[model samples]
Target: MQVLFGYNTNGGQSVQSYGYYDPNYANDIRTVMVAVVAQSHVQTPQQDAPTKLQLIPAVPASQSITGESLPAVYFYPPAGSHNAQFTVMTTTVPVMNMIWH
Candidate 1:
């Protein structure tokens, strides 16, 4: 039995994974790529059928911006008043998490 996993790093960084086969095995055989649907799917057995990639809704696609709309974030001066302290208002970004598995 073997367990394999992957994570990306820029080059020259430490490689971390747990498995038995040589990393070179990945190069000799054709790759089996499947669309990652969700975290729950990771534990699924892979032998039932052809290795498939399912595009599950991990994160909602951005429907709001589609060439005609402004981006979710923007910065500009405040309206209607001039200030003497000269400090610009700060902006905040919504926290985002991307699961690369």
Candidate 2:
């Protein structure tokens, strides 16, 4: 599986980060999971740890066709944050896991 990350800055005060996943298999996939963690890039260690951002599943399990080229899922992180990371994992099988920092 391959995961892609992007960000949009036009809507509000906070920047929005999006995650895209591609299983690259012909068969439909329903067990893929996407997660995002955002941390404020503060200069000091006293800052809080990364927070779990809310993920909005773009496609349902039934409609997650591999070749559609659209994002199987997407997420929006907290606004005005920095140092975002993304993780992709498969729940059903032992496929490779991915993490982006």
Candidate 3:
């Protein structure tokens, strides 16, 4: 599995983003999980200090039969969720793991 990261600057708000993973083989199946965490200093006053990572939302999973390039799966941090960092974890069994930004 592979991961890519960038920012979306079209139209409205620009968002920090990342995506696109294709299995090694044409018939292979894989699942990708994505999450974002706010930088410590970005936490709001009402929010508790985050001691652990939090899940954002699931990126569209990928399945390809023709081995053709799969559609790009992109994820963005919530609006106003500033100073945020993103993570994408990929595994065969739908589990969360380490991903570098």
Candidate 4:
């Protein structure tokens, strides 16, 4: 799993996600991509920007297919005034767990 964050040409935020796979595995190929956006609001002037990345693990009950452990990620803004966005991409056999900042 790999992630990248940067500013777009129009001064907006951009997120790029990439997944790596082993060459040995010819049939086992899968990718799970997750993105979370925290929209900025003008009415909430007192709201402080998040300083850290948050990763919330999925419980058994929250799993998409009964036993799968899907993750929920929160990627905050680079600057306080801009909206926050993040992308999570994974390509592994049986979908391995990924924890990154």
Q: Rate the local accuracy (lDDT) of all candidates.
A: 0.24, 0.35, 0.35, 0.35
**In model 3, what are the clashing residue pairs, if there are any?**
none
Off by over 4 Å in 3: 1-63, 66-68, 94-101
Candidate 1 lDDT tens digits, 9-72: 3222223221223454332221122221221222224333223222221212231112122222
TM-score of each: 0.15, 0.22, 0.28, 0.30
Between prediction 1 and prediction 4, the one with superior lDDT is: 4
TM-score of 3: 0.28
- The order by descending TM-score is 4, 3, 2, 1
Put down candidate 4 lDDT per residue, 1-101, tens digits, no spaces.
Answer: 23212111222222222222234321232333434454534434455545655533333423232233445445555665433333333422223223111
| Model 2, span 42-93: residue lDDT tens | 4343443244433444543333333233434334446544344444343222
The TM-score obtained by model 1 is 0.15
Q: Backbone clashes per model, in order? A: 2, 0, 0, 0
Q: Which pairs clash inside model 2?
A: none
Strongest candidate by TM-score: 4
Q: Point out the worst 10-residue segment of candidate 4 by lDDT.
A: 4-13
RMSD of each: 23.4, 14.7, 14.1, 14.4
Residue pairs clashing in model 4 are none
* Superior by TM-score: candidate 2 or candidate 3: 3
- Order the candidate numbers by lDDT, best to worst: 2, 4, 3, 1
Error of model 3, residue 77, in angstroms: 1.1
Q: State model 1's lDDT.
A: 0.24
